[model samples]
Structure formats: C-alpha cells, structure tokens
Target chain A: DAGITQSPRHKVTETGTPVTLRCHQTENHRYMYWYRQDPGHGLRLIHYSYGVKDTDKGEVSDGYSVSRSKTEDFLLTLESATSSQTSVYFCAVSAGVSTDTQYFGPGTRLTVL
Target chain B: AQSVAQPEDQVNVAEGNPLTVKCTYSVSGNPYLFWYVQYPNRGLQFLLKYITGDNLVKGSYGFEAEFNKSQTSFHLKKPSALVSDSALYFCAVRVLGGNKLTFGTGTQLKVEL
Candidate 1:
C-alpha cells in the first residue's frame, strides 16, 4: 500500500550460493530498511539506508549486506547463502525521521538448503 | 538500546468479543511505539503508532492502541473481533533519536466465529 514492491517474491537456493533481493518504492521515502523475519524472531533489522550511498548495519548483519544507490531502490545481498539465513525478508521505507511510520513491502521468502 | 516484548505467543477470541494483544517495551529515552499486522504471506501493515500527545491512538481496520508510559506498554485493542483479524501482530520501538526500530517476537491472533 506504500507503493513498495519486492522482486522475486519467492526463491530457493542451495547453501553457499549467492542471493540478492530487491526493494523498490515509488513513495520516494528517504529511509529504507531491510529486515528478516524468523519464527522465534519477529523481525530483525539486517541493514538500512538513510540516503543514497549511505548505509548502516543493523543487529543481524552478519551474512548480509545492503546498498542504496538511489532513493527508490535498495538492495540486499547475501554474500554466500547459508541454511541459517533462510527467512522472509521485508523491505520498509520511512519519510526520513524516527517518529515517522515505516511502510513495508510484500516481502520475499528465501530458502537456503 | 530499545526493545519490545510481546508476552503472548497467541491470543484467541470469539467474533464480537473484545480483543487485546499485549506489548511492553524498554528504552533509554522517550519511545516511539508502533503496531503492525501481517496476514500470512503478506508484508507487515502499519496499524498504529504512538509518538506523543494522546495516549489512545487509533489506526487502520478498527484497531487502536493505548500507550501507557507508566507501564511502558502499548497494547493493541479492538472493540469487536473479526475472523479476518486473525494474523501475526508485531510490536516495535524506537528511542527518541534512534534511527532504527527494535521489534518483538510477535503474537499470533486467532479470532474465531
């Protein structure tokens, strides 16, 4: 509903392989975030970007990386996928403030065997 | 650091019955609280947020949340339950100046007819 869309809604890949998910927003929000949702962990922040070429690591950024080359697009890449990295990845965008509400994309379910 | 806790793993309510999902948080400064709902395979949808001012915050889909600073809680409530309301609910918190949000493990709501 926030003009956000995630590509490759579902994906499956073998362990030790590389994977990437894309998030696109038409809202032109300045803050973009990537989160992984697991059963016991509601949603853990993986990485976020506040502006073009400006990014920061989140609580669980161990095996993942992110890049925001433009205001409308953010990319999350798994250097080498692992079984433990299998989870639903969600992308969120906000209007550049902590108090502003963040809207989420449809999410991508990734499985690593 | 800011963190949120969803005490119940699941909640059940009959149609037309009042429903509540509990949430508690800990933060170093004034908190920005939020509630999100995820319907299976979909992304998280913003339900409501509490930044300041009124303690009772109303949101989408007939949902409301009360921010109790004394209790450090922001619980999601609905006057009457609907079977379609069954889904996963998540609580999140952000400190006054923090740029990121910390989320709880989530609670599953089961509204039956």
Candidate 2:
C-alpha cells in the first residue's frame, strides 16, 4: 500500500531465456532493494540501489543484475534464466539507510522450466 | 556482516493465547533490528523496529518486540493471538552505518482458533 507496484505479478519462462522484473515506486524514496523469497530461505537480498545509477550487489546477486536509470524505476534482469533462479521476487523502498522503514510491493512469482 | 536467526520454522498458538516468535542477531556494530510479516502471495510488511530507544518497542497490529543486547535477541510478542495473524514472520538486522540488511529464515505463525 506504499504506492509501489511490480509488473508481471506472475511469470513462467523456460530456462536459458531472458526475463526482467520491474519495480516502480511513487514514494520518492532514496533506497530501492530487490529481494528473493524462497522456502526455507526467508528473504535474501538480490541487489539494491541507493540512488539513480548507483547499484550494489547483495547476498544473492550471483546470477542477477539490477539497474536504476531513474528514481522511480528499479529493474531486476536475469541475463540467462536458470531453474535455480525461480523464486518470489520482492521490491522495497526506504527513505534512507540505517533502519529506515522499508515499504514492499506485492511481489512477482517467477517460474523457470 | 549482520545476520539474524529465527529458531522456529513454525509456531502454533491458540486464539487468545499469548504468542511469541524468537529472533537472535549478530552484527559488527550496534544492530538495528526489524520485524516483518508476510501473508501468502503478498509482500513483506513492516511490523516494528528497534533502533536507539527503549528496549521495549511496540508496533502495528498489537505487536511488540523486546531488544536484549546482552543476549543479542529481539523477540516478537503479542498478548493474544488471532487467526488472522497466521503468516510468515521475518527478522532482519542492519549495522549502524550499513545500507544492506540480512534477514532470518522466517518463522511461520499459525494462530488457530
């Protein structure tokens, strides 16, 4: 309910294909984060951007990439999808770092076959 | 590096019964702890956070958490349980000057009537 939306709420694509999930926010927050939620793994950070064009890798950013060309949009792209990459992806925005409250979008459930 | 642990994979409680979810954290600096709740098919929602204040932190939806620096734990508790409270709970941690967060594996709360 934080004016955050994720495109393609559900997606199913074959392995080795390219896939992108978009997170758009209207909150004007400075920090945007991408996280993946898997069973038994809770939620792990995939990538995050502090500002436009300033992104950094997270704990689980091995096969994922992110970009923030503008303040409102944060995109998570899978260069070449793999079966292991299938998971529920969530995007969150925070006013600032250091324990600022984070607001999350609904989610994107991705399946790789 | 900062990390949090949720010992229970699942917790069961009867309606009107007191409920508690355990969380312990490890951080290099003063820890900033947070609790989030996730319903099925939805995104994570912030419940409460402990920054630099009283050890007892109260949050939304009749939830409260106690921060114990000696034990490095921040446990979530509610005086009474509700069937609607059934969801997955996550505990996350961040250092004083860190922008990234580390989350626990999540505990599933089943508040049964």
Candidate 3:
C-alpha cells in the first residue's frame, strides 16, 4: 500500500448530475493517473498529470476532466454523470521514470442511475 | 500502441494444485509488462513487473510471471493454489517512451478449498 487514498469509497448519483472523485497521495510522485474499471474493460485511462498543473488526456478522456493543482491531490470530475460512467475509479501514482511501476489507491465505486 | 491480452476469462483450480493465467502483449519496442490483482470491491494491487533483466519475475503472494519475448507473452504462474488466492488478475503493458499503460480485460482465478 503506497500511501494513497481515494475519497468517497462508494457513491450513488443520479444521471445528469455532476460528480467528482478525489485521489490523494502521500508520496510526491511526479505522475498521477485516473482510471476507470469496468466488468469487461479491465481498466481504461481517463486522464493523467505529469506535474502539479500539467495534465494530459488519455484514451478514454471523453466525458471526464481532471485537475492537479497540487502535488498531493488529483481530482477527476464528471460534468454530467451518465449510466455508462458507472464504474470503479482508481488513482495511481508513478515516479515518472521509464518502466517504473505504479501504485494504486483503494478505489471509488460510482454508480449513476 | 502497446496492448495486453488475457485469453482466459476465468480459471479454476483446487487447493494445492498448480495454476496459471495466460497473458500476451504487443508493443513496438521492448515491452514493460506488469501483473496486478484485484479483490472484490477493491482497487488493483501491484504484483510484479518486468522492466529489464531476468525473464522469470517473482511477485507477491507466491506468484511469478515468465516473460517470453518470442511469444510476446507473460503468463502468471503459481506452484500451488490457495483459497485466498482467488481474485481477478490483470495484465498490463506500457508503451515505449510513454507513461501510460494498457491493460487486458482481466482473468478471474478461483482456488477452491
């Protein structure tokens, strides 16, 4: 367990409502990532941050947004929740070295109805 | 693009029996492979990774994965299965010069008592 924590371990929200998930890390890693896990999809990268404010979009960044204003926190926000966005969200941190391993947070289970 | 594939959806083994979960990968340059496990309602936990070095990589909880460049495979193996080992396993590969990882659909392992 790398010192990582995700807020709101479980959440249930209505469709079209805004939702936000938080990931906090104790280790000041240079890279942070947000991923969503589904039954058959394993996990899909939603967004990533290289520095405090430098972020990039991932393959599945479409209905999601991320912000990293500080080294310890990375936030993922869903502008308007949809049923398809219902999944387990995980936050991971890496040292930014090539071939480095990532440490994951506990995860947040979100369901949109 | 780097990608991983877990051919089996589920694997069943009795306690004390040897178990294996297959994983294949495709990448342009040398592949950085990883194995992770997820318990029900929990986040993904890092098991092992093959950055560079020996092909036989040992991981946590009596698990090991062999990297075969010729076959583009990194199959996870265990000498003996335990009921506590039952969980979902995922295979992942990171693209060259990129920090993002692509994961497979995942394989569920059931070790019966």
Better of 2 and 3 by TM-score: 2
lDDT agreement with native, every candidate: 0.94, 0.94, 0.93
lDDT of 1: 0.94
lDDT of 1 by residue, A16-112 (tens): 9999999999988999999999998899999999999999999999989888888999999999999999899999999966699889999999999
In order of lDDT, best first, we have 2, 1, 3
**Interface RMSD list for the candidates:** 0.8, 0.9, 1.3
lDDT per residue as tens, model 1, B62-109: 999999999999999999999999999999998766888889999999
Q: Write the per-residue lDDT of candidate 2 for residues B33-69, one digit (tens) a residue.
A: 9999999889999999999979999999999999999
The true-versus-predicted C-alpha distance at residue A72 of model 2, in Å, is 0.2
Q: Docking quality tier of candidate 2?
A: high
lDDT of 2 by residue, A1-113 (tens): 68999999999999999999999999799999999999998889999999999999998999899999999999999999999999999999999988798889999999999
Candidate 1 residues lying further than 4 Å off, grouped into runs, are none
For model 3, state the Cα shift of residue A18 in Å: 1.1
Reference contact recovery of candidate 2: 0.86
